[model samples]
Target: MIKVYGITTCGSVKKALSFFKAKVIPYSFVDLKTTQISEETLEEWLSKQPLLRLFNTKGTKFKTLNLSKELSDEAKKEWLLKEQLLFKRPIVECEDGALLVGFDEELYLRTFSS
Candidate 1:
Protein backbone atom coordinates (compact mmCIF):
# COMPACT_ATOMS: atom_id res chain seq x y z
CA MET A 1 0.00 0.00 0.00
CA ILE A 2 1.11 3.54 -0.68
CA LYS A 3 1.71 5.75 2.39
CA VAL A 4 0.91 9.43 1.98
CA TYR A 5 2.33 11.83 4.55
CA GLY A 6 1.01 15.36 5.02
CA ILE A 7 -1.54 17.49 6.80
CA THR A 8 -5.07 17.03 5.53
CA THR A 9 -5.79 20.72 5.21
CA CYS A 10 -3.02 21.44 2.74
CA GLY A 11 -4.21 22.18 -0.80
CA SER A 12 -1.57 20.06 -2.51
CA VAL A 13 -2.26 17.21 -0.12
CA LYS A 14 -5.98 17.44 -0.87
CA LYS A 15 -5.29 17.38 -4.59
CA ALA A 16 -3.09 14.32 -4.28
CA LEU A 17 -5.67 12.49 -2.16
CA SER A 18 -8.44 13.43 -4.57
CA PHE A 19 -6.39 12.23 -7.50
CA PHE A 20 -5.82 8.89 -5.81
CA LYS A 21 -9.52 8.52 -4.96
CA ALA A 22 -10.62 9.48 -8.44
CA LYS A 23 -8.23 6.95 -9.94
CA VAL A 24 -9.28 4.22 -7.49
CA ILE A 25 -5.82 3.97 -6.04
CA PRO A 26 -5.39 2.62 -2.54
CA TYR A 27 -3.37 4.76 -0.18
CA SER A 28 -2.94 5.21 3.55
CA PHE A 29 -2.64 8.70 4.90
CA VAL A 30 -0.18 9.78 7.60
CA ASP A 31 -1.21 13.11 9.05
CA LEU A 32 1.97 14.94 9.90
CA LYS A 33 0.15 17.33 12.22
CA THR A 34 -0.90 14.47 14.49
CA THR A 35 1.95 12.03 13.95
CA GLN A 36 5.66 12.33 14.41
CA ILE A 37 7.90 11.17 11.63
CA SER A 38 10.97 9.26 12.72
CA GLU A 39 14.49 10.43 12.01
CA GLU A 40 15.14 7.15 10.27
CA THR A 41 12.21 7.75 7.94
CA LEU A 42 13.39 11.28 7.20
CA GLU A 43 16.86 9.94 6.47
CA GLU A 44 15.35 7.33 4.18
CA TRP A 45 13.49 9.98 2.24
CA LEU A 46 16.63 12.11 2.03
CA SER A 47 18.47 9.16 0.54
CA LYS A 48 15.83 8.89 -2.19
CA GLN A 49 15.52 12.60 -3.02
CA PRO A 50 17.39 15.81 -2.39
CA LEU A 51 16.56 17.65 0.84
CA LEU A 52 15.48 20.75 -1.09
CA ARG A 53 12.92 18.71 -2.94
CA LEU A 54 11.53 17.25 0.27
CA PHE A 55 11.47 20.59 2.07
CA ASN A 56 8.86 23.29 1.53
CA THR A 57 10.59 26.64 1.38
CA LYS A 58 7.65 28.58 -0.10
CA GLY A 59 4.90 27.40 2.19
CA THR A 60 3.10 29.51 4.74
CA LYS A 61 4.94 27.74 7.50
CA PHE A 62 8.25 28.88 6.04
CA LYS A 63 7.08 32.47 5.82
CA THR A 64 5.51 32.44 9.27
CA LEU A 65 8.65 30.99 10.77
CA ASN A 66 10.79 33.62 8.99
CA LEU A 67 13.23 30.97 7.84
CA SER A 68 16.16 32.08 5.73
CA LYS A 69 16.66 30.55 2.33
CA GLU A 70 20.38 30.66 3.07
CA LEU A 71 20.02 28.09 5.84
CA SER A 72 22.42 25.16 5.62
CA ASP A 73 21.10 21.73 4.64
CA GLU A 74 21.78 20.43 8.11
CA ALA A 75 19.94 23.34 9.66
CA LYS A 76 17.01 22.75 7.34
CA LYS A 77 16.94 19.10 8.28
CA GLU A 78 16.90 19.99 11.95
CA TRP A 79 14.09 22.45 11.34
CA LEU A 80 12.14 19.80 9.49
CA LEU A 81 12.51 17.49 12.45
CA LYS A 82 11.27 20.21 14.77
CA GLU A 83 8.40 21.27 12.52
CA GLN A 84 6.64 18.78 10.31
CA LEU A 85 4.99 21.62 8.40
CA LEU A 86 8.41 22.38 6.94
CA PHE A 87 8.02 19.32 4.73
CA LYS A 88 6.66 19.54 1.23
CA ARG A 89 3.04 18.40 0.98
CA PRO A 90 1.74 15.03 0.01
CA ILE A 91 4.91 13.03 0.36
CA VAL A 92 3.99 9.65 -1.11
CA GLU A 93 5.89 6.49 -0.29
CA CYS A 94 5.15 3.98 -3.01
CA GLU A 95 5.16 0.21 -2.69
CA ASP A 96 8.30 -0.11 -4.77
CA GLY A 97 10.32 2.22 -2.57
CA ALA A 98 9.70 5.29 -4.74
CA LEU A 99 9.07 8.64 -3.09
CA LEU A 100 6.95 11.49 -4.48
CA VAL A 101 7.07 14.92 -2.87
CA GLY A 102 4.26 17.40 -3.46
CA PHE A 103 1.54 17.16 -6.06
CA ASP A 104 2.31 17.44 -9.78
CA GLU A 105 -0.55 16.37 -12.01
CA GLU A 106 1.63 15.35 -14.92
CA LEU A 107 4.02 13.46 -12.69
CA TYR A 108 1.18 11.68 -10.91
CA LEU A 109 -0.37 10.60 -14.20
CA ARG A 110 2.91 9.27 -15.44
CA THR A 111 3.75 7.56 -12.18
CA PHE A 112 0.45 6.01 -11.12
CA SER A 113 -1.10 5.26 -14.48
CA SER A 114 -1.88 1.63 -14.98
Candidate 2:
Protein backbone atom coordinates (compact mmCIF):
# COMPACT_ATOMS: atom_id res chain seq x y z
CA MET A 1 0.00 0.00 0.00
CA ILE A 2 1.09 3.55 -0.58
CA LYS A 3 1.57 5.65 2.55
CA VAL A 4 1.21 9.41 2.14
CA TYR A 5 2.65 11.74 4.76
CA GLY A 6 1.63 15.38 5.07
CA ILE A 7 -0.72 17.73 6.83
CA THR A 8 -4.36 17.31 5.76
CA THR A 9 -4.89 21.04 5.46
CA CYS A 10 -2.12 21.46 2.89
CA GLY A 11 -3.27 22.14 -0.67
CA SER A 12 -0.70 19.84 -2.18
CA VAL A 13 -1.76 16.99 0.01
CA LYS A 14 -5.36 17.58 -0.94
CA LYS A 15 -4.48 17.47 -4.62
CA ALA A 16 -2.56 14.23 -4.20
CA LEU A 17 -5.44 12.63 -2.35
CA SER A 18 -7.84 13.72 -5.05
CA PHE A 19 -5.64 12.32 -7.76
CA PHE A 20 -5.39 8.95 -6.04
CA LYS A 21 -9.10 8.90 -5.41
CA ALA A 22 -9.87 9.76 -9.02
CA LYS A 23 -7.65 6.96 -10.18
CA VAL A 24 -9.06 4.48 -7.66
CA ILE A 25 -5.64 4.04 -6.11
CA PRO A 26 -5.58 3.09 -2.48
CA TYR A 27 -3.44 5.02 -0.01
CA SER A 28 -3.04 5.63 3.68
CA PHE A 29 -2.46 9.16 4.93
CA VAL A 30 -0.30 10.10 7.92
CA ASP A 31 -0.85 13.63 9.02
CA LEU A 32 2.43 15.26 10.07
CA LYS A 33 0.79 17.39 12.72
CA THR A 34 -0.83 14.35 14.31
CA THR A 35 1.80 11.68 13.71
CA GLN A 36 5.50 12.10 14.30
CA ILE A 37 7.85 11.01 11.52
CA SER A 38 10.73 8.84 12.70
CA GLU A 39 14.39 9.48 11.98
CA GLU A 40 14.69 6.02 10.47
CA THR A 41 11.91 6.80 7.99
CA LEU A 42 13.47 10.14 7.16
CA GLU A 43 16.81 8.45 6.60
CA GLU A 44 15.20 5.96 4.24
CA TRP A 45 13.61 8.77 2.26
CA LEU A 46 16.90 10.68 2.12
CA SER A 47 18.62 7.58 0.76
CA LYS A 48 16.38 7.67 -2.29
CA GLN A 49 15.90 11.44 -2.66
CA PRO A 50 18.31 14.32 -2.31
CA LEU A 51 18.21 16.22 0.98
CA LEU A 52 17.33 19.37 -0.93
CA ARG A 53 14.33 17.63 -2.49
CA LEU A 54 13.01 16.66 0.89
CA PHE A 55 13.59 20.09 2.36
CA ASN A 56 10.85 22.67 1.82
CA THR A 57 13.13 25.66 1.36
CA LYS A 58 10.33 27.79 -0.09
CA GLY A 59 7.93 27.06 2.72
CA THR A 60 6.84 29.58 5.30
CA LYS A 61 8.31 27.30 7.93
CA PHE A 62 11.79 27.62 6.46
CA LYS A 63 11.49 31.37 5.99
CA THR A 64 10.11 31.87 9.47
CA LEU A 65 12.98 29.86 10.93
CA ASN A 66 15.56 31.60 8.71
CA LEU A 67 17.17 28.33 7.69
CA SER A 68 18.63 29.62 4.42
CA LYS A 69 21.22 31.95 6.01
CA GLU A 70 23.75 29.23 6.85
CA LEU A 71 23.24 25.62 7.78
CA SER A 72 25.15 22.40 7.28
CA ASP A 73 23.53 19.21 5.99
CA GLU A 74 23.62 17.81 9.50
CA ALA A 75 21.94 20.90 10.87
CA LYS A 76 19.29 20.74 8.17
CA LYS A 77 18.61 17.08 8.95
CA GLU A 78 18.28 17.93 12.62
CA TRP A 79 15.86 20.73 11.84
CA LEU A 80 13.77 18.38 9.66
CA LEU A 81 13.35 16.01 12.58
CA LYS A 82 12.43 18.89 14.87
CA GLU A 83 10.00 20.44 12.39
CA GLN A 84 7.95 18.01 10.30
CA LEU A 85 6.22 20.88 8.52
CA LEU A 86 9.52 21.79 6.93
CA PHE A 87 9.02 18.82 4.63
CA LYS A 88 7.30 19.21 1.26
CA ARG A 89 3.72 18.06 1.14
CA PRO A 90 2.42 14.64 0.10
CA ILE A 91 5.54 12.58 0.61
CA VAL A 92 4.45 9.26 -0.87
CA GLU A 93 5.98 5.99 0.21
CA CYS A 94 5.07 3.66 -2.67
CA GLU A 95 4.31 -0.02 -2.42
CA ASP A 96 7.48 -0.65 -4.39
CA GLY A 97 9.47 1.22 -1.74
CA ALA A 98 9.93 4.33 -3.87
CA LEU A 99 9.73 7.62 -2.03
CA LEU A 100 8.20 10.52 -3.91
CA VAL A 101 8.14 14.09 -2.63
CA GLY A 102 5.71 16.70 -3.90
CA PHE A 103 3.09 16.23 -6.59
CA ASP A 104 3.65 15.89 -10.30
CA GLU A 105 0.73 14.50 -12.26
CA GLU A 106 2.80 13.10 -15.11
CA LEU A 107 5.21 11.44 -12.72
CA TYR A 108 2.39 9.94 -10.72
CA LEU A 109 0.70 8.58 -13.81
CA ARG A 110 3.92 7.10 -15.12
CA THR A 111 4.79 5.60 -11.77
CA PHE A 112 1.49 4.36 -10.41
CA SER A 113 -0.91 4.07 -13.30
CA SER A 114 -1.62 0.55 -14.40
Candidate 3:
Protein backbone atom coordinates (compact mmCIF):
# COMPACT_ATOMS: atom_id res chain seq x y z
CA MET A 1 0.00 0.00 0.00
CA ILE A 2 1.07 3.59 -0.53
CA LYS A 3 1.60 5.60 2.65
CA VAL A 4 1.48 9.40 2.21
CA TYR A 5 3.30 11.45 4.82
CA GLY A 6 2.43 15.12 5.34
CA ILE A 7 0.23 17.54 7.22
CA THR A 8 -3.50 17.83 6.44
CA THR A 9 -3.51 21.60 6.05
CA CYS A 10 -0.59 21.84 3.66
CA GLY A 11 -1.73 22.76 0.14
CA SER A 12 0.61 20.31 -1.55
CA VAL A 13 -0.38 17.48 0.75
CA LYS A 14 -4.04 18.26 0.19
CA LYS A 15 -3.44 18.21 -3.58
CA ALA A 16 -1.68 14.86 -3.31
CA LEU A 17 -4.57 13.36 -1.33
CA SER A 18 -7.02 14.74 -3.83
CA PHE A 19 -5.01 13.41 -6.73
CA PHE A 20 -5.01 9.89 -5.25
CA LYS A 21 -8.72 10.08 -4.57
CA ALA A 22 -9.53 11.40 -8.03
CA LYS A 23 -7.36 8.76 -9.68
CA VAL A 24 -9.00 6.07 -7.54
CA ILE A 25 -5.57 5.08 -6.25
CA PRO A 26 -5.34 3.45 -2.84
CA TYR A 27 -3.35 5.29 -0.19
CA SER A 28 -3.02 5.79 3.55
CA PHE A 29 -2.40 9.28 4.91
CA VAL A 30 0.19 9.67 7.67
CA ASP A 31 0.05 13.11 9.22
CA LEU A 32 3.52 14.44 9.94
CA LYS A 33 2.27 16.39 12.94
CA THR A 34 1.48 13.20 14.86
CA THR A 35 3.91 10.88 13.12
CA GLN A 36 7.56 10.84 14.07
CA ILE A 37 9.59 9.59 11.11
CA SER A 38 12.37 7.20 12.11
CA GLU A 39 15.98 7.56 11.05
CA GLU A 40 15.88 4.31 9.12
CA THR A 41 12.84 5.39 7.17
CA LEU A 42 14.49 8.75 6.46
CA GLU A 43 17.64 7.01 5.30
CA GLU A 44 15.59 4.95 2.90
CA TRP A 45 14.02 8.06 1.41
CA LEU A 46 17.38 9.82 1.22
CA SER A 47 18.78 6.85 -0.64
CA LYS A 48 16.04 7.21 -3.23
CA GLN A 49 15.91 11.02 -3.41
CA PRO A 50 18.37 13.72 -2.42
CA LEU A 51 17.97 15.50 0.91
CA LEU A 52 17.43 18.85 -0.87
CA ARG A 53 14.36 17.48 -2.61
CA LEU A 54 12.77 16.31 0.62
CA PHE A 55 13.85 19.23 2.81
CA ASN A 56 11.77 22.41 2.74
CA THR A 57 14.17 25.32 2.97
CA LYS A 58 11.48 27.90 2.13
CA GLY A 59 8.88 26.84 4.68
CA THR A 60 8.04 28.89 7.71
CA LYS A 61 9.61 26.32 9.98
CA PHE A 62 12.91 26.55 8.17
CA LYS A 63 12.85 30.34 8.29
CA THR A 64 11.77 30.32 11.93
CA LEU A 65 14.52 27.91 12.80
CA ASN A 66 17.03 29.77 10.63
CA LEU A 67 18.11 26.80 8.54
CA SER A 68 20.86 27.18 5.96
CA LYS A 69 21.24 25.44 2.63
CA GLU A 70 24.97 25.09 3.31
CA LEU A 71 24.19 22.61 6.07
CA SER A 72 25.82 19.23 5.78
CA ASP A 73 23.73 16.16 4.91
CA GLU A 74 23.95 14.85 8.48
CA ALA A 75 22.84 18.17 9.92
CA LYS A 76 19.92 18.27 7.49
CA LYS A 77 18.79 14.84 8.62
CA GLU A 78 18.99 15.85 12.26
CA TRP A 79 16.90 18.94 11.54
CA LEU A 80 14.35 16.90 9.58
CA LEU A 81 13.92 14.50 12.50
CA LYS A 82 13.70 17.32 15.00
CA GLU A 83 11.34 19.50 12.92
CA GLN A 84 8.86 17.64 10.78
CA LEU A 85 7.69 20.77 8.94
CA LEU A 86 11.09 20.99 7.33
CA PHE A 87 9.84 18.25 5.05
CA LYS A 88 8.77 19.42 1.60
CA ARG A 89 5.32 17.86 2.08
CA PRO A 90 3.48 14.77 0.92
CA ILE A 91 6.24 12.20 0.92
CA VAL A 92 4.61 9.14 -0.61
CA GLU A 93 6.19 5.78 -0.05
CA CYS A 94 4.92 3.49 -2.78
CA GLU A 95 4.78 -0.27 -2.53
CA ASP A 96 7.26 -0.42 -5.41
CA GLY A 97 9.88 1.11 -3.13
CA ALA A 98 9.47 4.46 -4.89
CA LEU A 99 9.58 7.63 -2.84
CA LEU A 100 7.47 10.45 -4.32
CA VAL A 101 7.97 13.82 -2.75
CA GLY A 102 5.64 16.81 -3.26
CA PHE A 103 2.79 17.18 -5.75
CA ASP A 104 3.35 17.02 -9.47
CA GLU A 105 0.23 16.24 -11.45
CA GLU A 106 2.02 15.11 -14.59
CA LEU A 107 4.33 12.82 -12.65
CA TYR A 108 1.48 11.44 -10.58
CA LEU A 109 -0.54 10.68 -13.69
CA ARG A 110 2.39 8.90 -15.24
CA THR A 111 3.19 6.96 -12.07
CA PHE A 112 -0.34 5.83 -11.16
CA SER A 113 -1.64 5.45 -14.70
CA SER A 114 -0.01 2.07 -14.88
The candidate maximizing lDDT is 1
Arrange candidates by TM-score, highest first: which order?
1, 3, 2
Worst 10 residues of 3 by lDDT: 60-69
Order of quality (lDDT): 1, 3, 2
lDDT for each residue of candidate 1 in 45-114, tens digit (9 for 90 to 100):
9999999998899999999999999999999999999999999998999988999999999999999998
Compared with the true structure, all predictions reach lDDT values of: 0.94, 0.90, 0.92
Instruction: List where candidate 1 sits over 4 angstroms from the true fold.
Output: none
Identify the superior model by lDDT, candidate 1 or candidate 3. 1
Q: Select the stronger candidate by TM-score from 1 and 3.
A: 1
The per-prediction tally of clashing pairs is: 0, 0, 0
Candidate No. with top TM-score: 1
In TM-score terms, candidate 3 sits at 0.96
After TM-score superposition, the amount by which residue 15's alpha carbon in candidate 1 deviates from its true location, in angstroms, is 0.6
After superposition, candidate 3 runs with Cα above 4 Å error: none
lDDT of 3 by residue, 7-109 (tens): 9999999999999998888999998999899999898899999999999998889999977879998899999999888999889998898999999999988
